[model samples]
Target chain A: MLSFYICLRKIPPMTEPRINPNVSVDCVIFSFEDDGLEVLLIERNAGQNRIEDDLLALPGNLIYEDETLDAAANRVLRELTGLKNIYLEQVYTFGDPARINKQKDQDWLHSIRAHPEARVITVAYTSLVKKSNFKISPSSFARQAMWVKVKEVPQLAFDHNALLEKALEYLKHKIYIEPLGYELLPERFTLAQLQKLYEAILDDHFDKRNFRRKVLRTSFIIPLNEKQKGVAHKPAGLYRFDKSKFHKI
Target chain B: MLSFYICLRKIPPMTEPRINPNVSVDCVIFSFEDDGLEVLLIERNAGQNRIEDDLLALPGNLIYEDETLDAAANRVLRELTGLKNIYLEQVYTFGDPARINKQKDQDWLHSIRAHPEARVITVAYTSLVKKSNFKISPSSFARQAMWVKVKEVPQLAFDHNALLEKALEYLKHKIYIEPLGYELLPERFTLAQLQKLYEAILDDHFDKRNFRRKVLRTSFIIPLNEKQKGVAHKPAGLYRFDKSKFHKI
Candidate 1:
């Protein structure tokens, strides 16, 4: 039986067809902060029956028919989290007819979707944002939007857990090639902080001395004249990324 | 407005729903040979009207609802080309609503698909195949399956040209990171052949002496005892990739 009556945001007038029931978009939004690597999740609210109510899922919804995939991703993120202009990269598409065959999933979809039995193909995306950049407040059908550490995330709704795993794998591989870790940090940060970010994502420890030596050699990681303040121990020098230098290299 | 009625292969009986109209899979199969890097394309056959019927496209079709995205990609490749076990990598998913909104495209879809107006989201894959490994025979709706040099390809159907561009960019970036170019070569190849493969993919020339010197320094490329057979010029030494050595590094 359906446990919740999830109401999606009403669509505005569009020149093209209203919405494509067969296609949806999901996002694995990641942020780095005091809790290490964290991912944004939405807790689906309960209804009168209140059965199996604590379902957590990535912020996602069916895409509007007129919008492109990227636009759909952005709109979904904004509607669920009250955040916009996020840097989202398309990771993979998940399309198995049995994806929603589980009774609980079917029941949940029955409550929300017009066509509950439609085989939805979701285009998944990976997004990175600074922890302090935006405030999150759940909207539409979501009860609450919150950040959970990647390691501590419970079994998510739909195939979201698999999506999260793929996103992490993408991040792991991408970090080695690109300086994407900086997206999670502040404008100015220390080498230790940067190393910690890498360690959290890679789930491994690095020799402090060697890590610093290697990072300093890169033209992008420029050491600023500033230093850390309000620390009980010795202050660490601050650094910033040089985008022009990175592009040149 | 209909031109040619494209007849798809009959589907096997399944417990789940049949083909998902909203989801399709397209392949950008690439092979490196005498004419340089070539991509496999399908030429749609002409009908009685034959109006705008010179359509060329990536070998693709709507995916069965029961199969996963990867399985669908493999199956689509086999159905259209009569080739199996080809290594495929998912490059991207294109879901622009206007993608098939063009008049000719709409006419093409109307002639073939049951729900001609349905928005289709295609998950595109990039495949690498050796030229001499297998033969290609067009099946299903494809009038002809043929390899066209990447440079000589004309405007393709739907958003396939954009998909091909993305695949080419992926190949260019991936060649520098991984030794994927070997998938297009035989067990034994000469240094000159290797250099030519790189040149064709990168669209840039390399100093032969310097390129050979750098290649020789790599642990993975091992020089074989045999040399090229029956060449007008002096026979060159052959080399093979050492997978174990690559993994070790």
Candidate 2:
């Protein structure tokens, strides 16, 4: 049997000193809030390995040599956002050659050169987490990390805007087939919050009566004996996703 | 905006050689016959560039440069099978790294070195085509190309046997959501042939009455005014896939 290191070394060298960029994982963490669906964004450091010093982008990192892609994604979430045990799925591998070029800055090139150890080809992933669980770190490279409404996400660095859009599309497609909505909201959430999350990602208003009926028909949501508090109107009964009944389509 | 070629050149070299020796696409091009489901298989030649000598394998090729994964797949199907415009989809990307190492000959490495022009990262894609349509070319390296029963697929070279298993799994999954079975048979076919095709892939005995009921429920089957001519049993009604409705799902 070929040893692992020999197997790794056996890969043919490129025709030239070509950079076969290493694979990394980027997480688009989404959460449901009172306003609408929100995504976590981090303010990048202004210099030294920071491409867009002031720009916002998804939390991401290079995969370790020994880790699986999913494991790398979990590590990123834990390290960056101080949250764990969230629902994460591989969305797509963004290999369009133009992705890095879209970031028109000398700083980007310098940053890449500065970190010769990091050859990153990011595999974008999406995670749905409860908004309350995060304790965003004020890391040296990031000034702040906060959740912003999906609609208000501005000019993000790299191909992040595109990645976010793809993630949202995936979210909409998955919501119909899988019980993914539970990941975005609190453990016990009002039906209205759930509906708003759907509407935000779907970008259309659903008839409240029809929406409730369709969700209830899935048989994965269980109405709890709990109710929301501090609302101006009648408090809606809280519901939770029944994990036992949830199956991927 | 970066010029396309410039954009391409600026991208990092594929970290490893673009081709992985293990992964590959083995097409199971099915054609309708009087008896049942038939798939195309080729007898490989042992020329300098010909990798699989004196063995049978589904028509396949390695993934290529700057190509969309799907495009590379279509290219392989067209080149090896001489069939185009057939239904093609990425069934899966297999990366059991140890699979290549398990082969005793390590002929895959010699094959890679033999063809300096070719970079072989085998990404296997499965395509379903009406068996009647393909015009097999008599290439010097290939001894012969012929239709074979899915039940008796020859011992394939490399990890092709595993790839075929994955393809069959994908076909079963796709059959439920899409009208892909029609691609395997002729434009017009008896219900028995359709049932047999399903049985071949699913590898289970399905009740004819129940299978027929489910097939008809799909509403994408258009019953023709014709019937089977020389069947030993009752003449079955012929049907074609309703193209307009087939793709809607």
Candidate 3:
């Protein structure tokens, strides 16, 4: 494997270098669908001429000389997908030297002008956004970017598969502490939808009675006067996520 | 303030650099004292034969080219304290660009030969260790390192004051999710001592009745058949932190 930085540095005229400068930012952008969770994956250089064209990866870029790691993560997501104003936070740093040592990974990096064997330490960030909130776009480095089902994703470019796994692991824990489950559901949602979202992400069935009892204790998941309709089954009561009560919960 | 790397890249020959590497690891080592939460503070290199003899800072260093950020953090802690096999985990990264702009911060960096004006993006890690389990030592960069009460700590070098606060904030949440409270207590501890530890760190009282009830729910805090003796007050029943039950909790 080669080394690379998951940075968002605005590379000035000095375009190519022999060794990797190392630090970069990589984003694992996640969204929820009716059936399961989804993550945004960027096709490896879709616009560029292809050698081994069957690769996909998380949206990432090298950190520039002056930009904050946070800024770099936001820029990478924005540039790759035209996504803006979404919730994103730094999750962890992936700094193993052997991360880019795979043959296909090396070939891909050579084509992109990154040192195939240089040590790259990526600052990985996880973002959960409403899929409808942003549109996808291609980059000079990535051919095309799209959101795919988390379970259905194929081998991603570089160490991104591991990155994706880590991101989800982080999300599972984050949703429990914060109200991330709300992000996956509609603005006005039924209690069933919220429970299903939790069950799906956690890969376990949450008892309906116990779930409601525990959730109500949080003081943030608010009940709205509205209710769900147009379903084959009878309509269910609706609820809204109260942002102001977040900290207190 | 002057920018620096939180790394330990055994500098081979290239001694001085004009620019900052941007990414490094900083360790905020914490231990529990009998009365309060204590944090490790390293006095700035007074042996450099220069100014600012009373300044204190966290134990941090720039990352070496080949080591992972995790390894760098551990090595920094080990090199400075001679401590090993202690609990350590990533807390957060402090990356505000203006962090190094203060005059005192910059002077200290110049004396150490790090980039005086470059931006340093630091990955901060927090470690909780038994003070008795390890002995404190100094590195080339620190004059002496010692544990200071978290509340009594004055202004620290660079952004370390902010770093220490963040570590404690992280600790508050971590103790609940995991059995970190046990690290601060003896093998067998009284309910009053346990409540005091919680109160001291959160700076708020946990009602005695509510605390005992709530703590009983956590499988990790086990009731011991022993009691505290030779105390000024009543000898309270003792409890133990069960490591085996950590995952279950």
Candidate 4:
């Protein structure tokens, strides 16, 4: 008679052939630029299954096994966009089965078929970063990384457009209570610029007097002795975010 | 070469498996009782290879193919607790592989091994319902269902205790803004009862006068011109929630 261990070993192990799928992280990095509130979009190389010669999409990559979700997101951001340590957050999980192969050319479908062992489930996250901080370079996957206005994001593949909309709504809600405006602004920015950022996000005009008073009332802004350059209008006073006061509220 | 019709049928056939094993949903339903905030707990049946005999656990089930996360949550609540149309929201996802088979019971491990098709990844959600509304009935897999005070909940099985703690914290944070207190209170309750509900959830002593003033300031409380009865103390004024103004803020 075989021993229990030997018998168990002899029995064909129930194989989890479905490769837990390669989990990837995608970042819809937003920045308030001179143009408007914009999201970073990267162009993907045109392949046999891709209809467009250069398809545009969000910057993201596959997560490593030994890393946490935040760590994976940070690594993907740095590797893809040369940006590091921004205010990143997990927004939502995208697991629609159709998202894997919705490409017009069926190139991605063929790629997935070629690597049967690769079942990739991507976790989508978003980051609000200062547009001025980084010099982005196109990785091997695309021609270049460019900031596109949020309103102008065109027919993106998969559920990216819906993801972007959710991120924008999250930002609007977050900005009301948290000091999220700092993520879009530089180390020193004028009160007008801050107001403009709010307007752009809320998509509504605010009385400058009321807006200034409300922001100042929060007691989370520091007056920096600086001014904007190359502006013909009256130079507005610069201010920086008071992290200590912001946390107290 | 095969004809076009034959090639179409044979090549790139849609053979994707419909059964997804790695996803499930667990619910933590909290109710406000006369004592304090309570959570619904169930006893797992001592069935084949199920080691958690007579142990307390949250009401949960595997996600179905034709349902959304919210729909699955509603189904679980209705099927397990016999309650419906309550306040429900997704809290977080738990993916720790060791969370399932932490006990070193060979029989339990064998049960899990037997079900090779089951790779459970649970997403936790929390719901708030009036304690009086539920009709407790144990399912085929459970021994019984009972409302256990959150503070008195025993060491639960499968990270359920941790999930309950997280849900309590989420409720505490949400009470300040969202109209979630109504979910726990009876349709008609006194001012003192409302204050006690807040105190129970926040776990902090609030000045009675101040709490009353703050709640009344919202103007979403309708004075029912009724008073508490069968009590050994002063009869407090009864009030009902103004549903139209509940979600205004």
Contacts from the true interface found in each model, as a fraction, amount to: 0.86, 0.00, 0.50, 0.00
Residue A189's lDDT within candidate 2 is 79
Which candidate tops DockQ?
1
State every prediction's TM-score relative to the real structure: 0.88, 0.69, 0.84, 0.79
lDDT of 3 by residue, B20-138 (tens): 25567789888877788889888777444666554788888777766777888888777776667666788887777678778887887777755556567788899777687778877
Which pairs in model 1 have colliding backbones?
none
Of 1 and 2, the candidate ahead on lDDT is 1
* Candidate 1 residue lDDT tens string, A173-208: 778778885689899999999999999888899999
DockQ of each: 0.66, 0.09, 0.39, 0.11
lDDT of each: 0.85, 0.67, 0.77, 0.71
Each prediction's RMSD over C-alphas, in Å, is 7.8, 8.8, 8.8, 9.2
Chain A alone, TM-score for each of the models? 0.90, 0.79, 0.86, 0.81
* Residue pairs with backbone overlap in model 2: A19-B13, A20-B14, A20-B15, B19-B121, B20-B121, B23-B122, B24-B122, B24-B124, B25-B124, B31-B131
RMSD of 2: 8.8
- The number of the candidate with the highest TM-score is 1
Write the residue-wise lDDT of candidate 2 on A99-153 in tens digits: 5554442354456444533323466789777777766764635556888988899
User: Interface RMSD for each candidate model?
Assistant: 1.2, 5.1, 1.9, 4.0
**Per-residue lDDT value at B76 in model 4:** 78
lDDT of 4 by residue, A35-126 (tens): 57899887765444444553567777655544555677787777767777776787665554455555442464354344523334456678
Error of 1 at A178 (Å): 2.7
Docking class of 1: medium
